[model samples]
Target: MLRCHEVTIQVPGRVVCDHLSVVFEAGQVWAVLGRNGAGKSTLIHTLAGLARPAAGSVELQSTDESARGARARARIVGVLLQIEDGTYWGTVAEYVLLGRFPHSHPLMGYSRDDIEHAEAALDALALTTYAGQRFATLSGGERQRVRIAQIIAQRPRLFLLDEPLQHLDLAHQARVLDLIATRAREHGAAAVMVLHEPLWITRSCTHVLVLAGDGTAHCGPADEVLTRERLEHAYGCRLREVDYGAGRSFVPDV
Candidate 1:
């Protein structure tokens, strides 16, 4: 549902990716893999229309992303940034309800359907018990789950998640990954996530994007792009591949 055309992303002294052309389609879960400072987060922001690329353009559903109004865009594209402001002083339920802002009427506020969506999202994330808690009082992992729940409530056609597994425990991580994968597989939503773990990609992602942090990138089906050589080069380290019943797993040689 999102396409990047010859996109060039740059940081202060480094070019993240150059002439990067890729398409993220419905029913696919994509993983963006890279070392720290490799511009994974930058690329996500650019794709979400929160940042501008040095060259080329990004399109959502065949139209220029930047051309759409904020609410209109939010209705189709949901984003979870790596970092979030901690200034929100609302209750957890209130905070989650904010996800419906795009769908809410300016004068009428959130509808019953919006509340149902938000409640279901919270339940999916296992945050039903914490609905009355203050958002700032929750633990890091809990907060992360809440953020993800907010996005789920939005029910966007495309999900752009930057480090979605951050601060999450193994169980929560699996839950989140499965949730994303299920959304793509069953609901036809597209997801592009910045993930540090290769095993998780093998478990759930259909496509892969590997960035070498030098303006070079590899993108294709996960099985084809996640070869030992490319992963080693992109990660700048040695990895041992292990055969598993479901798929392959890459572990650090060290």
Candidate 2:
């Protein structure tokens, strides 16, 4: 499981979350919701151990033993950021192969199992044909999918995705989310995704964490915490839930 204890995350002149704590269990999906500049990314990074917390601690304890240090932690937590920042001069296949580095020995190359995992991830993301294509040549959406594919290839115990739906069309968004949810359930992995549209927190997510942008946060089961009041408070705007008998839809009150 992945857990944070009284963790405080803050940047210069900006506060994301203060003395916050949460835990993510296997076979569950959690979404982080809030307005822009609400320190969503900062909080995600802190939880993933990519960034240091101002106070307290973040720990990951496997079912049997503990994986200590950065290298061991990397073997368990897979992170995908909002943007693919660095310039890559390699093929899509080559880039995806990097995900296996955590499990490899020093000065080691890709093993047969590693290649197989990368190929499976590529197939799952419908990028098998593009495997030979240059990573830089792919479009924004394509690059985003490849980035996600890399994570799948890693086969980590916990997934940390920040704004994963960026640069994708509606179809790809749904497709990618489906794959993420399926993978988590099948592998008994825990997924924590940062999403912009709270409305898209589909049935796949079991829990939620909403940042109020006021140095506070709220969390609970999805059905209980994803109410209009909580969402409006987090976004600092008025929104209404329209009842359509079978379900409810979230939209602006206007």
Candidate 3:
């Protein structure tokens, strides 16, 4: 589990994360919901330790107190940012194996277990067929799945994903999101993901953190946070919830 207490992040004249405090509970999926520039991504990065909070701290709750350093933190937390920039040369398997670097023995390279875990992660994401393919050669959705596979191989106690549904077809998006949600639930690892779609958050997340543009948080259960009023308030638009037969969807009235 990860805890953010009274965190504040300032960038020049902007206060991206304003005295924000939240807890990511184990075995639960948390969906961070907000419109663009609402600090969802900033919060994710802060939790991942990529960006230090201007105030307060991010602490990982672990059974073993030994797992408490940067290197140890890498093994305890995995991050899947929206962008995959340095992924041009390595094979899919190699890229995924990089997730094991934090645990690799010095001067020993990757172990047999590391390779097996990497392969299993690829297979879990149905990317085994593309194992030998270079990262640069894969399609957008394929690349996203591959990136997720890498993160899965990390075997972290906590998972942080930013806009994980981006650039993927509906099927792949569902597959990837469902897999993460299921794994987190089964393994008792905490998961925090940023999602643009209200429906995905409703279906996949146990908890929701709705962020408004002015840096206020509406935090609660998924059903409570996914209301039309909350969506309209966070997004600054009128929204209507339409129930058609089996499922419902939210649409902007603007």
Candidate 4:
């Protein structure tokens, strides 16, 4: 479990959220929803102990008060940011293998188990063909897939993804999201992703976290929190829900 205790987060010009407390459980997929610049990424960074909160604290499942919390958290938490700098000058395999650093022995080369995990992750993401290719040469979507493969190879207990499908086609989007969900359930891990699409939330997530862009946030089960009104309030737009076969879909009333 990841617990935030009365956390307050703010940006240089805007307050993101104030005194917000929430808990994320294992084996559950949660979607973080908000408009642009609502601090969705900031909140995720804070959860990963990459950013400092204004007043409160984030407690990871591993409560090893002896060692540095951030180091301990990394052993259990996996983070995928929205973008990556193109400065890395290495092959795809080398980049993906970096994820296994937390598990491998220091100063020693990657073990056979680590190599197998990296290979399996590449195979899962269909990136085996690009293993020897330079990371800078891959297209944006391809790079995204490789990063996803890296995190999968890491196999952390919790996954924090920000706009993970930014550069993917429809098929890859579904495939990646499904893969995350399947891996989460199979490993009893947790996923908290920042996404713009409500369709993915409905299909892949069990919980919802909506930042209203007004220094406030709401969270609950997906079914209870993803109503048209809640979405409209979070997005500040008119929306309508329509029955899509047996399920439903939300569209803007414009």
- What residue runs in model 2 are displaced by over 4 Å at the alpha carbon? 64-66, 243-246
Q: Total clashing residue pairs per candidate?
A: 0, 0, 0, 0
Winner of 1 and 3 under TM-score: 1
**Lowest-lDDT window of 10 residues in candidate 1?**
59-68
- For model 3, residues 1-254, the per-residue Cα lDDT tens digits are 78889988765666766777788888889998888877788888989989999998987778878886777889989999987678368799999999888888869999999999899999988989999988898888888888888888988879899988888899988898888888888888888999888777767889998887775787877877788888888888888898756566688776
Residues 1-254, model 1: lDDT tens digits: 88899999999999999999999999999999999999999999999999999999998874544537889899889999999976989988888999999989989999999999999999999999999999999999999999999999999989999999999999999999999999999999999999989889999999999998889999999989999999898889999999788889899999
**Candidate No. with top lDDT:** 1
CA lDDT of every candidate: 0.93, 0.86, 0.84, 0.89
Question: Per-residue lDDT of 32-106 in model 2, one digit per residue for the tens?
Answer: 989998988988888887789999898886863557777778889999987658989999999998898887776
Judging by TM-score against the true structure, name the best candidate: 1
Residue 139's lDDT within candidate 2 is 90
Model 4 residue pairs with clashes: none
Better of 3 and 4 by TM-score: 4
Off by over 4 Å in 3: 244-247
Question: Candidate 4 residues 146-206, lDDT tens each?
Answer: 9999999988889999988889989999999999999778878899999998888888999
Those runs of model 1 whose alpha carbons end farther than 4 Å from true positions after fitting are 62-67
Question: Candidate 1 — what's its lDDT?
Answer: 0.93
Cα-lDDT of candidate 4: 0.89
RMSD of 1: 1.8
